[model samples]
Target: MKQYSRVTNGYTVVDDVTTRPMVRGHNFPAYSFAANFKYLYLIFATDTPRYDYATGYLSTEGKILRGLKPAR
Candidate 1:
């Protein structure tokens, strides 16, 4: 598993995996169940107005984020 964040670009990255050890000396039945895993990433950006008078002006901004859920 690995995780990293870049402040300069306001972006985040994550990598991960889930695995189960094979049953030892067992052949009657073989199966594996999900252990529940999730991942998320986010990025942000901002801009400033060019005019000083716009400082008090109301502004709207937007953001984007990604989310992942474990397989059922």
Candidate 2:
């Protein structure tokens, strides 16, 4: 989500809804994940009989992370 504000100076200020790290500790389920200049792809063992496995993406800075189902 993005938010904008108007000021008398004829300029608009913009802000976006984003999430940062929650717990202050070293994370990333495993050590050997795939990465490049911008993003990373990793598998998270869901450990659930139904889900089985899942996918995750993280920015290089590890700030923007999200989860999704792997493509069949």
Cα displacement (angstroms), candidate 2, residue 68, comes to: 5.7
Best by lDDT: 2
Which 10-residue span in candidate 2 carries the lowest summed lDDT? 21-30
lDDT of 1 at 2: 19
Candidate models: Cα lDDT each:
0.24, 0.34
Q: Which residue pairs overlap in candidate 1's backbone?
A: none
Superposed on all Cα atoms, model 1 deviates from the true structure by an RMSD in Å of 17.6
Please, what are the lDDT tens digits per residue for candidate 1 over residues 1-72? 112322343333322223233222212111111111111111111342332322332122212222433359
Which 10 successive residues of model 1 have the least lDDT summed? 30-39
Off by over 4 Å in 2: 1-53, 67-72
Off by over 4 Å in 1: 1-4, 7-10, 13-49, 54-58, 62-72
Per-model C-alpha RMSD: 17.6, 15.0
TM-score of 1: 0.16
TM-score of 2: 0.17
TM-score of each: 0.16, 0.17
